[model samples]
Target: MAVAIRLRQEGSKGRLFYRVVAADQRFKRDGRFIEILGTYDPQKKGENTNIDIEKVNSWISKGAQPSETVRSLIKRQVKAQASN
Candidate 1:
């Protein structure tokens, strides 16, 4: 099975929260996830949306794929790191 790291939507309408998860590629967007690596809360302040960076890196290292949106987030993360 192709493993993927991606987001699952949460919260009420007009307000949104998401969890970053690892799951089978064939699963639906919000379907069962193998693991919850971290979360993304846009409502939170900088760095408060604590992601398990080590876990994410570990999954990536293990050859888990990331969806397009997750890939964009990864790109942004890289840019942020570069600017630091």
Candidate 2:
């Protein structure tokens, strides 16, 4: 099964919240997921998201592809972590 790491949109409208998850590509965007890697709160700036880098890397190694937005989020998180 092709796996994809992507965002699962939640929360009420006008206030967007997201969960970073690993799921089968065939599954609907917010339908089902294998695991919850972390969360993203766009309304907040830096330090607004929390992701398990190890888990993400593991999934990637296992052939899970992350969506564009999730990729950017991962990059941003890495950059922020490096500064600490």
lDDT comparing candidate 2 with the true structure: 0.95
For model 1, the superposed segments whose C-alpha errors exceed 4 Å read 74-84
Please name the candidate that would achieve the greatest TM-score relative to the true structure. 2
| Candidate 2 TM-score to native | 0.94
What tens-digit string does per-residue lDDT give for candidate 2 at 1-82?
A: 9999999999998998999999999999899999999999989975898999999999999999999999999998899899
Give per-residue CA lDDT, model 1, range 1-84, as digits (tens).
789999999889888889889999899988998999777787877753445667888899989998787776666666666698
Q: Rate the local accuracy (lDDT) of all candidates.
A: 0.81, 0.95
| Model 2 regions more than 4 Å off | none
The candidate that wins on lDDT is: 2
Taking all chains together, the TM-score of candidate 1 against the true structure is: 0.76
lDDT score of residue 77 within candidate 2:
87
Residue 18's lDDT within candidate 1 is 90
Give the TM-scores of the predictions, in the order they appear: 0.76, 0.94
